[model samples]
Target: MSIPAIDLMTTLRSGHSTSPRLTWYGPDSERVELSGRVLDNWVAKTSNLLQDELDAEPGMRLGLALPAHWKSVIWALAAWQLGMETVLDGGDADYLVTDRPDSSGRHDAVIAVALPALAMRWPGELPAGSIDYASEVRSHGDVFMAHTDPSASVCAIRAHDGQQHLHEGLLTGFAAPHEDGVRLLVAAADGLEAALSNSLGAWSSGGSVLLAHPDVELTDKLLAAERIHGK
Candidate 1:
């Protein structure tokens, strides 16, 4: 059976235009917010960087090894926009995206992302052939046009214990209602399940996400502060 492809970028654009879409809180109380249009711009730039600079194409698997930062969410959206598969556990991918030191993982192309929202340069020296994501992504165009229809299979979420599940799109993988104004708050360890559950639930529903790092001690306090409606 042929899978019906739903472009993630298209879905995001069709949502409310001026509302806040994504918010991130770091361990040290740093915060960043993006509206639907701003988020889409980041996605487009990242997608273009992947396609033009990293040679990403539909059906290619890109390893995502970063934490649940806002940039990681942007990368996930960009990968799906390009019709590329996201591999969450650093396994079986053509390229690896990681912010970890020594980020030259097994992939031929490595995108080293600096997690600090304002930082322009990667703090450490990456191995040969590793590209700094922050430095390279913004130089690419701010709009992306896919070369072909995206396949239904959008991502491969691998658990730390070696189990894997493929989803049509990251948002569709969850049972969250795709309704409007459903703000979600997440405070779990940085992993595939936690990342997608919070991000997809909000994006699919025309809502927003307030992602808090696991190190943040007061989950309820943060949620209330952010006016989050769901966990």
Candidate 2:
């Protein structure tokens, strides 16, 4: 019998819920770990907020103007869950999400994000129409129901060094190696492509990812300490 098709959110919510799914290392050796269940909960809340509060639909375009942080990862997964397209360049978006203090964009909706894990708010007044993401997303439920088909386009990224197109189908087909429990170590220098690819691959293969901020140097000793098996 053929298996039913599943989106990224479904994939995340299934399987070992308590297994470690993401490990992030920031400047000053700050480390944060998230289990599969925790990550799924965050994704669900973000998705609910996007679909319910923001009126985001499958074809909507969202601008992601943040660095390779864990929150950014959550936002990407939420966008995929809503079947929305994520534009890394922040071009012509229906909504724009950023951690930058000075919000500058042409998006209809703006969300100012605070990168700190414990930050409960965006701090101070933002642009007139902008809102604090951390504060708003918490009120959302811990589950999501997709409004579009899983086969529909979820995201689009620049391909061939911005010379071609990398559609959702092709991205979905980029499977990871069958090796179980693969823990990938990611660097900010790898850019969005590496971040998304590694994230997707790890989740698809029932593995996890470890991300390091640009300010932190990843050494062999650190890799050994973190038990990072791949990059």
Per model, state how many residue pairs clash.
Answer: 0, 0
lDDT of 1 at 195: 67
**In model 2, which residue pairs have backbone atoms overlapping below 3 Å?**
none
lDDT of 2 at 9: 51
Instruction: Give lDDT tens digits, candidate 2, residues 78-98.
Output: 876666767787567898889
Q: Please give the lDDT score for candidate 2.
A: 0.73
Mark the regions of model 1 whose C-alpha exceeds 4 Å error after superposition: 1-6, 101-105, 153-170, 174-180, 188-190, 219-222, 229-231
lDDT of 1 by residue, 16-128 (tens): 55677888777677788887778888989998888887777888888888877788888877876666777776568898888874643567688888888888888867777
CA lDDT of each prediction against the hidden true structure: 0.71, 0.73
Report the Cα RMSD per candidate: 3.1, 3.2
**Model 1: colliding residue pairs:** none
